[model samples]
Target: MINFPDDIFSEPADVDPDTLANLGPLTRLAGVWEGRKGVDLNPKADGPEQRDYLERIEMQPIDPQANGPQLFYGLHYHVHIVASDEDTTFHDQVGYWLWEPATGLIMQTLAIPRGQVALASGRASPDGSGLLVRADRGGPGYGICSTDFLEWAFRTDSYELDLRFNADGGWSYVSTTMLQVRGRDEPFRHVDKNTLTKVAEPRPNPSARIAAGKATLAQAHGFTTIGGGAGKGD
Candidate 1:
């Protein structure tokens, strides 16, 4: 028995355009970041194997999104990783990090090229130093999904990610995925961790850019008179 809102299609009347200003906990993640020291541990047929890798991540602001009365400010992100000794790509991922200021809710939606997608949710303070989100195999809201091959060979049971903001403006994350591999008696915890340094700042969202452009044009045309200032002639 679930309740439904009759006005589900009605959007909010007053929506803010500045995503960066409204991002709350996700504000620190906006920028281009690079990490040279990344570690990955995964279960192999014989046993667990460790690998050192390099990682780059880019997070940029997106315009405010609305679902009825619900609004979200988010960052669209892409992550690329490569093994230290290899030239080929070790892993690639794309995701969105969303925050709802009204509810103190944070969500991460991730998609990997290997045919897996997940949505994880958590709660955080506006200025929290750390955050954690998790998703399970058979949850109603936040859950994990995978392709047929992955389901048959290495089934994922749960996913968890913990993020920490350092004092020096850098950030680090530890991600663990519980996998139930075929022929294995127990679940394996595949983990990855890295610390990233900001390389470039994020750009304004489209709505903010438009508003700034309008303000610039108004200033150039000496429209200050409209706000009680005298015109150039008087």
Candidate 2:
């Protein structure tokens, strides 16, 4: 038997407009980053193949999102990778890193061009320096999904990502993917790791920009008022 909220249609009241202020554990990820020492181990027909890659990632804040009473502040991100000698993209990914302030829940939604998507979930403290999130093949909430061709050729069993904020003000991640390839006797562990340094700062969210605009206008108006009053007094 399953139980759900009766007032599911009602959304949360007094939601915060500033996403960066409410991102909790995901706050450190909002920036443009680059990694040159990325390493990837993937399964091939013959055996495991190792490759080095250069990776760039950009994460920016979005407006507050709500699901009935549950609210989320998240960062929209894009990742692109290329080999050292190649100009073409080796891998590309887009995702959202979400943090729920009310529950201390961290979620990552990933979508690749290779017909696979996943939602991974975990828990973390607001000021924590590390996080680990996972999604299993048959989980009810955090689960993996793939196209039929991928399911038959290279079935994915699980996905996990471990993230850490370094003392040097950079971030690093290790991603492990469990795969059951066709005709393989054992599942293969596909792994990738990289430490990223910030290349650029992030832009403010839409709501924050609006707030700043309003503040600027108010300050201009006050200046004008004070100028006119001083002229009359003179």
Regions of model 2 farther than 4 Å from truth: 1-5, 125-127, 214-234
Which residue runs does candidate 1 get wrong by more than 4 Å?
A: 1-6, 125-127, 214-234
Tens-place lDDT per residue, model 2, 78-146, is 999998778999999999999988777899999999999999998764568789999999899899999
Which residue pairs in candidate 1 collide?
A: none
Q: Candidate 2 at residue 191, lDDT? A: 98
Global fold similarity of model 1 (TM-score): 0.88
lDDT of 1 by residue, 1-234 (tens): 645468898888878888989998898899999999999999998899999999999999998998887889999999999999999999999999999877788999999999999999997644688889999998999999999999999999999999999999999999999999999999999999999999999987767766766434334334556655533221
Q: Which candidate wins on lDDT?
A: 1
lDDT of each: 0.89, 0.87
- Pick the TM-score winner: 1
